[model samples]
Target: MALRACGFIIFRRLPPENIEFLLLQTSYGEHHWTPPKGHVDPGEDDLTTALRETQEEAGLGLEQLSVVDGFLQTLRYEVRGRSKDVLYWLAELRDPHTTVTLSPEHTAFRWAGLDQACALVQYSDIQETLREAHHFVLKRNE
Candidate 1:
């Protein structure tokens, strides 16, 4: 069975129509940067896992986010020779200035624009996902 994980492509809007996405740097492995996410626990639904992981990893609670409607992306990839599937839901941070508290799972955090976000994440699929999400937000607001 494919390993499943879920998370939010968390973004915050700035003045004059700028948007920045959040990326967390891992404490382990290659220390790749990614959106806050984690494995789905047994008996937990995907959305719950996403929310729980975001809170645990990034210290962002559901109340701090406005979950975007009609935007979801799934990426299938291999990790350590095993198939993995990740679901990402887009969410806008309710307050752009909200403080980010990082857990031990992440060594650092960054808020970057589309191009920078794409560059920070090493995976092509994640880069494409960030592009899609940026476009989705722009289109939805128009």
Candidate 2:
């Protein structure tokens, strides 16, 4: 069985209709960058895990985010020889100017446009997920 994790693909819209996605750099390991995420706790549902992880890791809670409808992506990969599955759901910050507070697990964070975000994230699956989420938001707003 694969280890499961969940998080939000958080985005904010700035002036001139620029949409930026949030990415955080881990303090440990290879210092990889990714959206806020963590392992699913026993007996907790996926959405609950995503919400909890977002709040714990990014300081953004359910009240600050407007979860997007019909948008979720699951990425399966190997971590330290163990299969891992990460589920990411699209969400928009209720206020674009809201600040993000990071916990000790992450060393830094950035809000970047799709291209920059893709470049910052080392994993190919994450890059693709970001691209897809970007397009999904664009299409939904049209």
Residue 116 of model 2 has an lDDT of 96
The local distance difference test score of model 2 is: 0.97
TM-score against native, each model:
0.99, 0.98
lDDT of 2 by residue, 39-100 (tens): 99999999999999999999999889999999999999998899999999999999999999
lDDT of 1 by residue, 6-113 (tens): 999999999998999999999999999999999999999999999999999999988999999999899999999999999999999999999999999999999999
Candidate 2 least-lDDT 10 residues: 114-123
What candidate 2 gets wrong by more than 4 Å, as runs, is none
Candidate 2 local lDDT, residue 104 = 100
The weakest ten consecutive residues by lDDT in model 1 span 57-66
Clashes of 2: 0
The lDDT of each candidate is: 0.96, 0.97
Give per-residue lDDT, candidate 1, residue 37.
Answer: 94
